[model samples]
Target: MNIKKKSALVLSAATVMLGLYTGAAAQQIEKPLKKNTATTFAIVVDQETYNKAKQEINAYKSALEKQGLGTYIVSHQWTKPEEIKVVLQKLYSDKNRLEGAVLIGDIPIPMVMDAQRLTSAYKFDQARFGFRAAVPSDRFYDDFNLKLNFIKQDSLKAGNFYYSLAPESAPEIHPDIYTARIKAPAIKGKDKYELIRTYLSKVVAEKEQQNRLNHLMVYSGMGYASESQTAWASEQVALREQLPQLFRAGSSAKFVNSRMQGDLKQRLLTEVQREDLDLAIFHQHGESDVQVISGYPNVSFPQPSIENVRRYLRNKIQAANRKKQDVAETKKRFQATLGVPMAWMDDALTDSVVLADSLFEANGNIMMEDVDKIRSNVRMLILDNCYNGSFHKDDYMSGHYVFGSGKTIVAMANSINVLQDVWTTELIGLLQHGVRAGNWFKEQAYLETHLIGDPTFAFTAEGNTDYNELIVNKDGSDPVWKQLLKTGDADLQALALTKIFYAQGAASSSLLKDVYYSAADASTRMQAWKLLSTLNNADFKAVLKDALTDPYEYLRRRSANMAGDFGTDDLVPALVASGIEDWASKRVAYNSGNSMSFMNADLVIAQLQEYLKKPEFAGNTDIQRLIKRQEGTREKVLKEGKVMEDKKAVAKERAFDVNMLRTYTYHELVPQAIAIAADAAEDHKLRLAAVEALGWFPYSYQKDKIVALCDQLIADKNSTAQLREEAMRTKTYLLHFSAEKYQTVAKK
Candidate 1:
């Protein structure tokens, strides 16, 4: 059930107001329901689910209320998210600022369609099965500003505006929506409410077991990309810095899975069998039932445009076989002649050892059954990869391993958009707060939606952790800091700072400034920026102005995001003068084309566009010159790429550097710039790709072709809303650029 509404079934105030249901079998009493009242958290449940699980919910709400979380239980129609939006708006008015929300029941996440083409379809998680439509993000309600007047549904700006992204295919149903799998007596045969209740009950029990004997842990699986691919491969190295808050990581060597000594399953099972873990986190590739740890070699894989490369290799194997060579001899000849690394053809790449056989294997990695079988108390599990949250429908199958009978409350990305590096930093930061797993996971998702620009990742539990404990205490840290300050030990002090302020807590700005200036270590200094980004909300104007100019380019580049998130028009001069460089090598092709990734630069550009829209900065000569400078630089880069890519006469088994693309692109570019040029002529890649960026340039320079063609795209309702938005936004960008040339602001 995709939860599309067929008819409206409205429940009146009388039905909802009557609460505190007590039954002959039930000793628990439900409290009175609060509506239109201020509360810290909002729990939105569907009517059908509410009626079925009334007793369980009452007990749950009662528990939450006792913990200082005044709960608002609101029943909503499954299809009518607009009504839910109304409820949320009322809940988050000027009088009340909500901290978070828990969406209960099988509520439909209405498909989000961006009016601008700023986003791309994220189908990484479900790519294996060609099932990616479910970008089930709660963004629509979460970011609701509550001003949308939809009497005749109008522009997005008219209401609660949130980011929008769609998948290539529709996403599948979330497990919480329908019970297709799970055999746990606590979950199966019961409605989704009971199953979720069982899962929560398990979390409560697991928390009770955390007596400081259970360890907090991090798990990094096999490399999806090589060392050269710093964006993805740098995950573990980055995570190493955040692991200081956990216990005995230095002493517990066996629990860590840095080396793939055996199969991934056996290694994980061994860790679980040996000791209880309070938190277990993984950074790897995953599907609904499988996790990809260490990599075997996959660079030989060809992009769709270069399928001939596959034929080229297969022909070598066939020729050797025709010569009556043995199978091994033929494979060796093929490997030798084709020049594809023989190491890449290793059969074990998809073998039983490195992958999770949770769904289909005789005996393999932690499947659903293994959740209880781990033989130790496991509280929380986080799988940071694609489609990792999609639970399978069989009890003896994947469900046992996925949503275990509360063995662990999991955190994972529903759609794959490269979450490893981004999330590990955010996760470690949240863990410092020592918030309950559920609250911590909610914060993770909320931050992720902003940082990743995709609001599709999810936390399994909502409205749960209210322990209000801090993972890193000043008491444990004050002595270490005092010792470090007395000894003038920078290295030891850096470690102490990690235990004190890696993330999620606040310290005096004066104290943080002292640490920032005094710390000799760069990493320690960077932590100061991390805390400042969150804790120092005031004077961001002045703070960002100074930080963006820091000599550390990494720190300088990070300031782009910080400034963009909290900056107003006033910060434009500082951002432009900063001229920070970001790693813009995000590539599109492995065998076809490698070009400079325009991701970070585009963020900078977007911030500037916002400035251009302001009355004070709009059409200013200085701003115009800066915009032109960036536009010209991009044009030059594109032209250079065009020349280098044009040189590819034949598809090599390796990459053609659209200027060193072969070296650093690591076939991660998939294709050289020339291939992109070729593909556009064959298809529409180049024209479509440049539509938005080119918008920043003068239209006359492009002979107005972009404006005309893109206008047609905008008018074509048959085309996707995403493409049209891209077309119109680019037009808007160009008009802004054009108006600046004439020293006037464009009305758009």
Candidate 2:
């Protein structure tokens, strides 16, 4: 173990002082507690397991009771997850007796199956490109209050959490109910009950132990996000300013993008595997199988983008390409052109991303598979990413823990978008004041409900038929109502307006116009636009034109989407300006169009193309709206970020998906897309997406040019293998123009 620094421990204000209770048997505490009971818990067990492990179960009760908890043990057949929720809710409704609950034995986990039409990663080559859904929820069990975010049309979301210690693997029950929080000792050839005991024992000791370690590893992976400028990176200066009050000065090890040694991920892993560090915080994109940290520097540029040799060669002749039109970062911010690197995502699985031989197993790459080998005394680990917490014991035992550790994993319980800064900062404050790791997310889930009056992590415009019922008709005394009627706080006022619209379902043009024109919140302005669309066509058009100068990106993006929907061709220039406005912010549409949440960005990007068709047809309604009904402007905007964020965005990282898969045609916007496809400075994900759009470019106006573009890509020796392969696939599948079909024309 390596020691970084030394410090005196400061007692937390919220820390509980434990009284010694020697040699006491466990006793169950029933309802109607004494007025001054210190703490309470519910221990839920599978009825079958109680018969075999009644004594062992009693030990669990004793362990918790020794820590000053009034423990209650209950057995249930565990029929439906809803039944479990009702039981817990009924217990918690009595605030005096319930603070948290533990599920012991083979409790079945509930799942949220998110089936959306968005392009999902093709499982294999033979799979057709089509819309799909997944179980994206990670924290389904935490919200006993019950709001699963899986309701968008074509989207089936299940946010129910049930951690079970069954003999069968989780996949056998459901493909998505993975909890990467624990290292199942079944892999170590130990009994599962013994592992649970170990976990409970460790937690109890850590919370009660007077000794404290101050060292922390603060890690931020500034890897290849959509674009370099939009790295899932937040400034460290904010952390520097806020941390010392909670932790000792100079007791932290920060691994950020700027200050890195040999390999960023390797360095961080080396320290974490050690038995010394107490806590590690990773702030970046991650997955169930890997953490998207700084990759091989040789393979990835240290800056926003790498110099594209091909762009310089082609720039002289291409006058109307998307590159020429793009004004986001290249010409506007960096004053240079850069492109995605040649090293593919597959590199992470090969020597392309090699690790120190001793540190990594024979097959491992950047992803460390050493949670089961943890010699560390770490108490907690926080990974803020989708599906990162989808860890299972079998994986750890088989040496496949993606980001797993022996410590309690603090992560998003499901596949929902959580504001990292807000929740993380709050958690740190609680920990500093002595809240246990096991209880952090429970506190967070409940707090989220109180703050926004909802238990779901994300809300979308797609298939939530229950939004009106959920948002509307709240108690008149709720805080949002109070703010709406009494105060002028912009955020609260905006929230109030959205709730009112949902409850009433209609608004006169004058009332909508007032909020549209003068509501202080940008979100409020955006919400006003949706309701205004219900008005006369002329009124809607006028509002969009006026929105051209709206102060925030949210309103402006919504205006652009409305303009597209109405087919206002004259506003092309305004749409372009908005599409590229503050492009690096990494919103759902990201540097394209900011249609409320992810829908309009998706709509407007293609809309920018489709509406330009023929230069005469009023805005065509052909482009489908994926999320039609949203909770509010914030739900429309922030929630879409959750939807559009790709699992592995860059080329070859995720399965190939072209938004044009459904349309398979190019509108007049091909030139703009061509400009993007031809540009070297664009993000690889965007460029690849553009290339796919170009694959079917000949479907309409570019029909005559398809053969030439395909041939050009196929013959280019310098093009990425990925691009060339995709071009070949397009020719093989979509165009039906194989070598045999073009052999005679190829000679020309």
Candidate 3:
């Protein structure tokens, strides 16, 4: 059948299935009895799965209702993502203020495009890759503030639709309601409907018991931050502040590192399988099918036993053969290195024992095939990696963890590549306050990040009040929030300050700054810094200067990382001081080095000279090396700028350089981008890339220059249609972002 005919047939089948399920579901689907004061939650499902698991779905609703949530099972044959978004928007505004929703069982997926800024670290040429470049996100449904322009549905994938976050929409993501996906993976030899039924039943059973926010396990794999020990250690310290109770005398908070064990794969499996383990965090690199936990096993270096040498030779020979290399040459090269005989090499190549040993040793990573055998009892799993939560794929890691034969109910992950610099554990302390996992995920709202499981899943409360209840009710007054700020719980105090910030905007700037200094808890201090930075007033510059020396290492690291965007000479002194003093901390030193490249180069150089003159740095041998590194990074930036404008360079490589400028916005590149965008003789694709890159400099001091260039291209009648279109987009983005920023200033 042709593509048109196939789509028509799918539509017809969807319509029929909808009619049949709606007729049957009138009895099983529970409509909300009370919509007042945001007490309702939604379970949205596709019709076919609802028909197959009606009893299981109803029991899941009962489980939520027992927990005081007025549950609604909205079963439909979802063809377009917009249809679901409309339903969610209506629910959000109606008397039944929706707190959260879970899209289950083959619901339509929205692939968001042209809004890379909303993501933590996702940027691609949408025109080149088309639908594939777009992110599979449910933010299209939950974030009502974002105005999206529906582009079209995927011609091949039935339920995949493309949308763009309109430039006129909200500049930042503040999701109106939390959302999760409970979709089962489309694995062969397994019935997805049966898996959904089993998973729903497990969720019901799991929710029946009181699950507490204790027994945490955190792991770090190789290749993240180049395995930076400082970043890894700081996370544990931050987690202690986030989950204070976990660090208490008898409670459990285990930290696992890949290098700590020779066979970490089995050790991770054993730890995850522990019944008492409440949460597991996998901080590593990943793909749709596998979690890359580590590289080679830790064996003795420089010298090794004969058996280990033989094992390494066997694995290398097998790899060479698989890659169509000459196995004889590979074996001979290993022989020369080890002085082994040719007969021994032949045996290593042909022996089944060698192959078996190679297979046994190659257990560093976890693949989709490894998921089915283990019953993971960890209540929640956080995959802090890339593409591990791609629910649209047939065999995704997060979906298998939730719906496979496991007690793992919820998993948080990203659908695309995410930045390592993101604060993954932000607002995590709310989990101890009885806030749902979905709510915690919602607050750290990135376009690509998602929760893959029940949205209503929550750990038992440690304190007297369920903070989720107060947040849902929307009855928080200034007086109530101020009272909470005085409470003993630091996370609660942070949440209260967030509420006040949202309501009062920059009006609360003074209070936030006060809290930043006076608050004893690191969590509260970090929260104060976050809100203050978002305001970006004069106070932000003052606080940022002080934060470089803040007792909280993570806070200091973040401050140094962001100081480049402000691009003022005032911050140069602090940035230099931190870079010199914090050189022992790999991530802090690394970020500070990068931040210097975007600041005033002369100011940075002057600051470095002053630092070298100090008596404390008289004997420091690394100072000159650090100065050269700063100069080298600036030179690298200059070279990359030239690459963006070089017509002789490969188009894809030049476009990549353009995208990187957006990630690390350097003011020096702004004029080059404007030049490329203005020259009509330039390649159309490159010009458009230039236009888009200019939008990311909203935080740069040279933003007005960008705005002027965008306006010029927008008005020129001789401009190409594509150029004009992109210019309009960039202009809208700059204006909307600036308006939002100054709105907070206006409130102050």
lDDT per residue for candidate 1 within 687-725, as digits (tens), equals: 334343333233122325556766777776664565566
Flag regions of model 1 displaced more than 4 Å.
1-39, 94-96, 115-134, 145-194, 204-214, 224-255, 272-275, 295-376, 391-402, 427-432, 437-443, 446-689, 693-724, 727-748
- lDDT per residue for candidate 3 within 528-627, as digits (tens), equals 9988877667777788899988877778888988788777777888898888888767777877887888887777877887878899887566777767
TM-score of every candidate = 0.51, 0.45, 0.88
Best by lDDT: 3
Candidate 2 lDDT over 346-387, as tens digits, reads 122233223332232222223434445554344455554333
Per-residue error for 440 in candidate 1, Å, reads 4.1
* Residue-level error in angstroms, candidate 2, position 707: 42
Of the candidates numbered 2 and 3, which has the greater TM-score value? 3
Instruction: Report model 2's TM-score to 2 decimal places.
Output: 0.45
Cα lDDT listed for each candidate: 0.41, 0.40, 0.79
- The C-alpha RMSD of each candidate to the native structure, in angstroms, is 15.1, 19.6, 6.7
Task: Please estimate how well model 3 matches the true structure, expressed as its whole-model Cα lDDT.
Answer: 0.79
